[model samples]
Target: MSTIEKALAKQKTKAPATNDVVTEEKNTESNESVSVNPAPAPTEKFDIFIDNEKLTERGFLHTGGNTTNQQEEFRHIKRKLINNAFGPASKTLNNSNLIMVSSANPNEGKTFVSINLALSIALEQDKTVLLIDADVLRPSIHRELEFENSTGLLDYLCGDTDDVSQIIYSTNLNNLKIMPAGKAHHLTNELLASDRMATLSKELSSRYPDRLVIFDCPPLLGVTETPVLASLVGQAAVVVEESKTKLETIKRATSSLNEDLAIGFVLNKTIKTSKDVYGYYGYGYGRKR
Candidate 1:
């Protein structure tokens, strides 16, 4: 079973913990029903085409395919994420709508999860999701979605672009927009850690209260910027490659994150059983230290 499912089962059989999932969407049971035909939230900018077929062939969640196991699996995970963003968890964390998805190390399926999660959130009846490729050191969202390498997050961060809207593009996928990592620069660390980033984070949070921002960050262990970026977002989903991600490395990676951040671990590439997908997510309250 997925961690969320396991946690729900545990809740049914035992006392609830501070980390249990809260706030089921009132329109429908969040973990059970997938909302269809979400009205597209319009945005002004270049039009981008997301190749659903290409993404399906890549084993990512099929946004266009409504009945697939991939879609259902992500639907379950995104509910918990959305709950933490807009539900009771929002009051506790800063910029609770902004979620950062990273990994202990590279090649652990963080980008894959980030994309699928965004797509799944776009399926929501009353929510929109913005997927930002913040892995400036090694960007992947554009390539994975088959969009042209375009100017994006780094361009704005480095003052190459005066407007953030120019970097965020509207996709054919309803209610989902994207911001690519833009051109890489030697000053990437400085640009990402600068004060301008803080201002942008606030704008993103307050400007769209119903939108969830997903930052696809670089792996946490080796990259200095990931931790720095982590501080800017309220929630962090650390993608842990099953069997390969060591216990010490996962703890070390998360230790660098801010104490106020709502942290969660996503177990990726597991042997899929009848009751679960290849990934599982279990979120918890942040440590006070």
Candidate 2:
């Protein structure tokens, strides 16, 4: 069996019987049947063509086929995040599983890092990943993954839908699921700070404590929603383009975040030189409180 097929078979074997699945009534006017503690259900899975050619052109990890140095870099980066999530370091944090990937400014490669990190984490034997497009103002996770656009975080927060399971999509990767940004809204910032959004965030972390929920948030400097979203996550990674991003910019971006959130810095697009052993790019863990 292929990797995807093997994953599907494993899911089927682990799934509870239909009658044993938990179901709850929708509190809203809509009568949708929502699963209270929806374990990764055996649902129809969609295929995402990682397209190594396209990914390499964009300077992303070529996860579609053969292993590359880029993939190895992310594996190393994810290991630290995973360690921080469940290791002894995580004992003090409440929602260490929720992570937000952001940048100092636009085009700093935060989205690329977010997707790559999610992909890397999904490869874990005992971990599943949920990549959320929290960059609602300019959503890109669905587009980057080449998945069809569907209702997502905003829809759940707007009261248009109460059942979040309806918007969450399972991918052929089995361990990776996606939550698109949903339709754009003028009051995006307000919606993100809503009570429902807070509830949803808590639900996502608590329902699947084993799952790593990664949010592709907007640039920290200019975006209003990013700071709000960052507050909800236990950890945040700020992607800084090597030589291009200014120290002042990084300072300004990081200042908006909560003092308690564990922050990390990822130096992306560094020039590859013969002197270095790891090719290009570097990462550093920021202050963790």
Candidate 3:
């Protein structure tokens, strides 16, 4: 073959190699573009909403109460209930700092309200708060806070350690601490009513008098735990599901409680209508439906 023929053959082979390089570069660029532009976040799902990290943010909208007004309204109710008690919530909280939250039935949003109330209390700068998931049968506050479920009140009561301080866990919130319930046992009520539980509370109250201790106990109806649990704590809060809970049911629940125990009733999943708010705020309460 001539020199030009040989050169032409070489160019033809080199052309295919150059084209392959171009194709590979184009594919790489396309993938880079796809990687850079991700799909928009889905906010519609229930699990996404509940499990979202932003849901736990201090002032994030729609997680607990929707707006500032709603938070203030709930806070006012908390204050009023605290005020109506004999020594007042502030004084009682200052003195002993132990608060127990319970309900008439299981699926009544008791845990939700208890967790939120603890958050509300923790928002206060000066107050240091400890939320104990004393509901041994089914503990959720620990899961909600996304803390380790390894150690807590159960460990302390079972004499896992002499120091209760080992169980206390610090969270993102400045003043708030958590004591999550460990493995569930068969006889929770008896364990709770034992001397160890009482000793733990007494020691905690004495150790951190300025700190608020919120105990999420079992329901009032299903088990005898609430009454037994209430007897141990200084005060109790009953979470009544709004629209679902009847007056008779609430009355029955109140009857179950001893009159001496200062119990405050909280309406959970409460809907606000025109009657609840003036014409100014429109219909919806939290995060615009």
* lDDT (C-alpha, whole model) for all candidates: 0.76, 0.74, 0.57
Best by TM-score: 1
Question: CA lDDT of 263 in candidate 3?
Answer: 62
lDDT (tens digit, per residue) of candidate 2 on 14-117: 44455554444442422122224433324444334344456566665543444566766787788888888888878866688899999989998889899888
Model 1 lDDT, residue 268, Cα: 77
Off by over 4 Å in 2: 1-59, 62-65, 273-279
RMSD of each: 12.0, 11.2, 20.9
Quick one: ranking by lDDT, best first? Answer: 1, 2, 3
Q: Residue-wise lDDT of candidate 1 within 1-289, one digit each (tens)?
A: 4322343344334322333232323334542323233323223335577666677678776544346556666777677778888899899989999999999889999999999899878767678888999999999888888777678888888888775556777676657788899988898889988998888888788777789999999998887999889889999888888789998888888888998888877777875666444445443333433
- Order by TM-score, highest first: 1, 2, 3
Runs in model 1 deviating more than 4 A are: 1-45, 273-289
TM values, all candidates: 0.81, 0.79, 0.68
Q: Give the higher-lDDT candidate: 2 or 3.
A: 2
